[model samples]
Target chain A: MTAVMETAGLGKQYGKRWALHDCSLAIPEGKVVGLVGPNGAGKTTLLQLAAGLLTPTAGTIEVLGGHPGSGPEQLGRVGFVAQDTPAYSRMSVSQHLRMGALLNSHWDDELAFRRIEALDIDPRQRAGSLSGGQRAQLALTLAIAKRPEVLLLDEPVASLDPLARREFLQVLMEVVAEHGVSVVLSSHLVADLERVCDYLVVLVASHIQVADDVAELLATHHRISGPRRDSRSLPADQHVIEESHTDRQTTLLIRTEQPILDPAWTTRPVTLEDIVLAYMGQARDQERARKSGLGVLR
Target chain B: MMRFAWLQFRNQAAVVFGGLAVVAVILAITGPHLVHLYDTTVATCAAHGNCSTATSVFLKNDHTLQILFDALVVVVPGIIGVFWGAPLVARELESGTFRLVWTQSVTRTRWIVLKLGVVGLASIVAAGLLGLMVTWWSSPMDRANASMYTAFDQRDLVPLGYAAFAFVLGVLCGVLIRRTLPAMGTTLVAFVATRLLVNHFVLPKLIAPTQRSFALNGVTVQGFGQMNGGPFTLFPANPNIPNAWFYSTQFVDRAGHPLSTQVLTSACPLLESGPGPSAPAGGGVESAVPAPGAGSALHDCIAKLAATYHEVVAFQPASRYWSFQWCELAIYLGVAVVLAGTCIWWVRRRLS
Candidate 1:
C-alpha cells in the first residue's frame, strides 16, 4: 500500500528562478488526482518531476517506492503525456503503435489499434496531417497502451476543442475504471478537473495552496460573511485561504475540519472555480505587498 | 532497433546510391584516359630532346588531377553526412515526435545508441566500398605516376576517415545545436576545416618528414672536377612540394656540376663499394655499367632510394586497408557513444 508518488519538499529550478517551490504531496494509488493552477503555477513542472522527465532541484521524489528515474522498468510503470500533445508529425498512426510496441514492455498493441480506429484516425495518415484533437487522442492512445501503474498527464486536453475535451476525459475515466491506474493530470481548466478528478491539489505562485480529497474539500470548505474583523482573531484550525473586505463587511473562504457552529456569520458552499479565483487574488495581493516593501497581508 | 536503423537506411538509399554512382563513374572514365595519356606523352617526350620538360609537366598534371579527384570522395560523403546526420535527431525534436519515443519503456540512451550504431556502421561500409572502387579504377595511373607526397597519395586515408568523422560530427552537432540548418552548417564547416588542417599539417608530420631535402647538382666531390659533375636535378621537384609554394622551386644548377661541386659529391654519391675506390685514375670516369666500385655508385644509390620507394603511393597498402577502415569507424562510433551519453544525462536530469 505504498504511495504511487511522493514528493518531499520538492522544488524545480531553472537558473535563478524556481518553477515549483517546496511542493510536498503524496498521491496514493487508485485515485485520480487533479493538479489545478493558474498560468505559470508550476503544474507541468511538478508533473514532469513525478514522471521522471526531470530531476528535482532541492528534494527527493519517489515513484512506486523508488527514485523517479530508476530505469526503464520504472519509466514503463509511469506513463507521461507531456503538454501540447507532442506527437511525431511524420509518423503514421500505425508507426506510433509500432514505436510503442518496440519501446514498452507492457504494450497493449490491440488496445492502441482499437483506440486509434475508434477515434476515426486513418492508420496510414501521418500525424502531421491530423487535427489537434486527433493528435492529442493519438498521444493518449500511446500512453494508455503502456498500461502504466501511474499516469502523469500535463495539460493533456489543453489543445482539444470543447467537444473533444469532454470525449478525451470520458475515455480517460473509462480506462481508469477498467485498469484502476493512478492518474495525476495538470490543467488550468477547473471545469475539466471538476468533472473527472476525485483528488485535488491547488497550486498558485509556485506554492501548494490546498491538497485534499475532492469530496472532502467540497464537503468542508465554505464562504463565510460577517462584520469586519482582523483575520488573526479567527480560530487557529479555521484556516482562511482567501479574504476580502468592503466597508464593514468581510468575506472569507476558510478550510475547516469541523462544522461551522457560529450563528452570527452566514456560511455558503463554494465551487472549485471560486476557490481558485480566491487563491489567485491572494497571490496577486501578496506580490503587490512584497514589491512595496510592506507586510500588508500578515 | 535494427529495424529502425534499417528503415532510416532505406529512406536514405537515394543519396547513398547517387553518391556511389557519381564516384564510380568519375573514377572509371577519367582513370583509364589519364593512364593512356601519361604513357604516350612521357615516352614521346623522353625520346624527343626534352625528357625533363615532358616528365615534369606529366607529373604536375598528374598530381593536380589526382588530388582534385581524391577531394571529390570527401565532398560526396560530406554532403551525405551533413544532410543525413544533422537531420537524424533534429527532425524528431523539431516535430515533437521525440516525446512518443521518449515516454516509452526504452531509455533515451538506448534510442540514440541504436540509431548511431546502425548508421555509423553503414557509413563505414559505404566509405570502404567507395575506397575499393577508387583503388581499382586508378591502379594504372598510380603505377605510372610518382607524386608520392602530393595531395592524392597524402589523401589516401582521407576520404574514408573524413566521411566517418563528418558523419559522427554531424550527429553530435545535431544533438547539441538541436536545429537542422545550423547543425548542418556547423558540421560542414567544422568537418571540412578539420580535414584540410589534418591533411595539410598534422598528418604529414606523423609518418612522413616535413621538409624533405635533396641536392640538385651534387655539390662538393672527392677527385672529379666541376666539368665531370654531369648536372643532375630532381625530375618532379620531389612531387611532394610544400602546400604553399607558388611554383616548383627550380634549383637552377647553372654551375655545370663542377668536380669539387659534383664529381660523386656527398650530395648524392654513387652507391658503391666504399667511396668510389678513392677516385680512379684517367679522369676517374665511373662507367654506368655495374662493376664493383663502378657499379657500387648506382647500386648504392638504388639501395638508398629503396627505403623511400612505394609500390602503390597513390592508394593505401592493401594489407593496411582494413586497418585504416576499422580505425576510422572506431573514431566516429566512439564519438557517437559520447554524444549518446550526453543525451542520456540530459534526458535524466534536464529534459523537462
Candidate 2:
C-alpha cells in the first residue's frame, strides 16, 4: 500500500525551542489514523508541517508522494482544518462555498451544498453569527469538498460540545467512506479518536511512542496482573510497554506477537485508550529524564 | 485570485471611491470660481501696480477649503496605510484565518501578490485622482509664487507615490509585527518619519543645487533697528531671483571670507529683525525704514563699511519643479518595490 503521509527525521523549531524532532513514520493511505498526544506533545506542529502551514527546520516531510507545499498542485492534494476551524466572519455561507469553488481545482460543490442544507445552515447567513458547532461544520464542509488526496485536521473537535463533536465525526466518516480519502486527525483525548480511528499513532513530548494498526495493537498488547515477579522474567518476545507494582503483586502491559502460554498470569486485551495512555506516561518520564540531564529510562 | 482579492477589498474600495467622488464634486463646483477670482484680483492688479490688497483677498477666498484639502493631501496616504494595509495581514494572523487560506490551492506567493496587486493598483488610482483634483484647483495660486516649496507635498503627482509607498510599508510592518494595532502605529510612525527625512535631508542632495553669487553693495538697504545688542540679518526677499530655494545667505569679506562674529556684531547696527520689541508690532515692512529719508543715511553708511564685504546665496532654480516631482515619485516607487518584495519573501519563507 502507498503511504499518504510520511516524515523522515522531521522537526520544527519556534524561536530556539524545537516543538517536534527526530520523527520518522509513514501513514498508509485509505485509513482514518488518529494522532493522540498531550497538550505540548508537538501534535499541532506535526500536522502543520504535513499541511504545509509550517516548514520544517530539520529533516523532511512528504504528503501524497511530493513535498508538502511544493506548489499549487501539491497544495491542492491536501486539506487542513486548523485548530479553531476559522472562517471569514464577514462572509455568508454561500460566499465560502464560492471561495472554495474559485480557489480549488477539484471542488465538489454538490457535496458541499448538500451537506450545508442538511446541516440546516442558511446560505445567506454570515459566518460571524453562526454558532460554534455550525462554524465547525462549515469549515469541515469546505475541507471535505476540496476532494483532497489526504486530509489533515488539528484538534478538529477540541472545542465542540459532545453532540457537535459526534456530528462532526459522523460527517467525517461519511465523507471518508464516500471519497476514500486518507485522514490524520490529532487530539489530546484518545476517546474522541477511538470511536472512528482504524489506525493509531501515539505521540508524546515531541516523540512518536507508537504507530500501529488499532486491531493489531489490540491483539498483541495485554495488561497482565498476577503474583509479584521481575519484569525480566517475561518471555523475550513480549516487550514491556509499561510496568507498575505494589507489594507482592505485579502488573504490566506487554506487547507480544506470540500467544501467552503461562497460566499463572491472567491476560486482558488492551483498549486503544489504555494503550495510548501507557505510551503517554512513558513519554512524560522520558521528558523528565532528559530535562534532568539523564539518559532515556529504557 | 484577482476575483478573490477584489472581493476582500470590495468594501474598502467602495468607501474610498465614494469619498473621492464627494471631494471631486466639491472641487469641481468651487474650482473655477477660485481661479477667476485669482486672475481678476491678483493677476490684474499686480500688472498695473502693487496689489497687496488683491493678494490678501485672493488668499482669503476659500480659507476653509484650503485647510481641509491641505490636511487631506498630507494625511490621506497615511490613513490608507493604516486602515487598508496594516489590517490586511494582521487581522488574518491575529484571528488565525491565514491557516484556512494558506492551506488552499493558492501558494502564499500568489495570495500576497494578488492582494497587493489589486489593492496596490487601487491605491495608486485613488491617490492619483485625488492628486489631479488638488493640483488643478491649486494651480492658479501655485503659479503666483516663484518657489514650489509652499505647497510641494500637498499637490501634484507625488501623492500617488506616497500612497503606494505607505500602503506597502504598512503591509511590511504587518507581516513583521503580526498584530493590527502595533502595525498601524508603526506604519504611521514610519511613513511620517520617512516623509520628513526625505523632505529635509534627502531632497537637497538628490540633485545638485545651484549657487548664486552676487555683490550686496548695489541693493537698497532697508534701515536696521537696534534691539538688545545681538545683531541679525534683516533683508527683503531678493527680487532678482524671487522664486529660488535659498539654502544660505551670509555676509562675507570682499575676498569671500566669512566675517567673524565679533567684528560683524560690533560694527553693524543691531536690528529688531521681525516685529521685535522696539519695532511697531504690525508696522509690517515699512517699519524697517520707518521714515523715508532715514533709509539713505543708513544705506550710505553701510555701503561705505560694507565695501569690504559681499553676500552670497545658495539656491535651487524654480525651473526644477516638475523634475523634483518626478524624481521624488521615482524614489518613493523604488523604495515601495523593495518593501513589497520583502513582504512577499517574508510571507513565503517566514510567516508561520
Candidate 3:
C-alpha cells in the first residue's frame, strides 16, 4: 500500500526562524503513527501542514497520496483536531454533528450520535456550556463523524484528565480498529502513544531524531551503564545518543543491533518513555550548541 | 445560503421588529397630524390674508422634517451596520466557528460569497422598503410645499444607497480587522464620512443654482428693503416674494459702465451716469428711483417700462431636483461597488 502520509525535507519558516525544519517522514497505510516531541518541537506545525491548515515554506508534503494543500477532496479525506479543540459556541452537540454531516461526504452520523449519547452529552446542550473534557469529546466526535481516510489529531488528549485521556485514546483505538483508517497523532505523552500507536516518529530540535516501528524501536534501544569510557571505544554499530557519566560509571542510551558482550557493562531494554527522553535531551543539547556555536557532539 | 441568512435574520427578529415598529408608530401618529395641522393653518391664513405667518411656520416644520428624514436614514442604517454587519463576521471569527466552516468541503470563496449575497439582498430590500414608506408618507407635503422637498438638498438617495454600503463596509471591516469593536468603529467612521461627503460636497454641487433670473413681475416683492445696490443676490421664486415672479440681473448699465449686479428690482435706471449738464442731450438718466414696496407709484412706472422691453438674464444658474438624486446616487453606488469589491478581494486573498 502507498504511504498514507509523506513529507520530504519539509520545513516551515516563520520569518527567519524555523518552526519545523528538515523533516522527512513516511507512514504506510493502516498504521497508527505517533509523533512525539516536546513543546514547540514543531509537532503541531507538522501536523497542521499535513492537515492542510498551513503551507510548508520549503520541500514537499503529501497527505494520502495527494499534496498537502490539495483542497476540499484532500481535506475531506483528512480530519484535523486542532490544539484548541475549536468549536462553534452557539451550536449544540447535535448541531455540530449536523455541521459535520453537511461538510463531509462520508459522514457517519450513526457513529457520532451513538458516541455522543453514550457520553451522556445532551443533544441540546450548547458547546460553550460543555466542560473541557466534554468539549474535547464533542470535537473528537465531529472529527470521527467524517469517516476520513486519514485522521490527523494534534494533541487530542493534551488537556484532558487521566481518566478522560485514557477513555479518549481507547475510543480512538476502537475507531481505528473498526475502520482501519490511518491516524497520525502528536503528543508529548509517550506512554499513551506506546499503548495505542503502532509506529513512532520522534522530532527533536526541528529534525527527525527517529522513526521506526514502536515495538521494534523498543526492542533495539538499550541503556548500557558502565565505567566511564570514550564513545569511540564502542563498536561501530552502536549509536550512543544521550551519554551521562559520573566519576565511576557511564550510563549511555544507545541504539544497537547486537546484544552487549562487555563483562563490565550492565545493559537493559529501554522503555518508550526512556527513548523519548533521550531524544528530548539530544534536542535540548543540539539547540544549546546551535545557539552558542559550541561543539558538544564529538 | 438564503436559509442560513434567514435564520440569522429570524434570530434578530426581535431587534428588527422592535426598532421598525417603534419608528413606524412615531411616523404614523406624528407625521399625519403635523401635516394636517399645517394644512388647516394654511387654509385659515389663505382666508384671512395672513398667508405670511402660516407659510413661515409650516415651512419651518417642513424644513425640520427634511433634516429629520436625512438624520433618520443615517441613524437606522448606521445601527444596522454596527450591530448586524460588524458582528456578521466578527462573531464567527471570535468564536473560531469560521474554521469549522472554512475547513469543510465547501470553498471559502463560495461560503463568503453566499453569505454576502444573502445579507446584501436583505439590506437592499430593507432600505428600499423604508425609503418607499417615507416617500409615501411625505408625498402630500412634498407636493404642497416644493421648498419643503429637501430630498435633493439633503442627499436622500445617499442614505438609501448607504445602507448597503454601510452593511458591506461593516462586514468587510469585521473580517479584515477580526475584532468586533474595531470593526464597528471603522464602519461608523466610514458611513459618517461618506454621508458627510455626499451632504456637504456632492449634493451642493448637484443642486446648487447656477443662473439667477433678474426680474420680478406681477408679484408683491418684499425684503431687498435695504439695497443701495452694489451686488445683491436673489433667490429665484424667493419665498419672501409673494406671487412675485423673480429674476436676477447679469449686468446693469450704470455710471456709463456695464457694472454687474444680481440684485432683483422693479426696474433698472435706463440711462448713463456722467458729469454732464442736468439735462444733458441723449443722456436720458432718470433722477427718480422706484419705491421699495409693492403697488407704489414709482414701482408701477418701472413695472410698465420693464414690461415694454422685458429681458430676464440669469445671474446664477438653474439646477433640477432629479439631477441631484442621480448624481448623489451615482457617487454612493460607486462607493458601494468599490467597497463590496474590496470586501470580496480581501476575503478571497487574505481571509484565513
Candidate 3 lDDT over B1-352, as tens digits, reads: 3454454456564666566667677678767876687668765776878876776676666566556765665576787788778888887787766655665655566667777777776666666556655665665455445443345333345456767777888998898889999999998998888788867676665543444334444332331222232233211223332222223432233232332332233243321211211211122233223333322432453364443332234322223455556676677667767877787777665652
Per-residue lDDT tens digits of candidate 1, residues B278-324? 33345524432233564445445434433443111122323443454
Where is model 1 more than 4 Å wrong at Cα?
A294-298, B17-71, B148-157, B208-352
Alpha-carbon lDDT, every model:
0.70, 0.84, 0.70
Candidate 1's docking class is acceptable
In candidate 2, stretches whose alpha carbon ends up further than 4 angstroms from where it belongs are: A291-298, B46-50, B214-220, B225-229, B232-236, B240-242, B259-293, B305-308
Of 2 and 3, the candidate ahead on DockQ is: 2
User: Can you give the TM-score per candidate against the true fold?
Assistant: 0.77, 0.93, 0.79
User: DockQ, in order, for the candidates?
Assistant: 0.45, 0.82, 0.35
Which candidate should be chosen as best, given DockQ against the real structure? 2
| Model 3: how far residue A23 lies from native, Å | 2.9
Candidates 2 and 3 compared by TM-score, better number: 2
Displacement of the residue B341 alpha carbon in candidate 2, Å: 1.4
Better of 1 and 3 by lDDT: 3
lDDT of 1: 0.70
Candidate with the greatest lDDT versus the true structure: 2
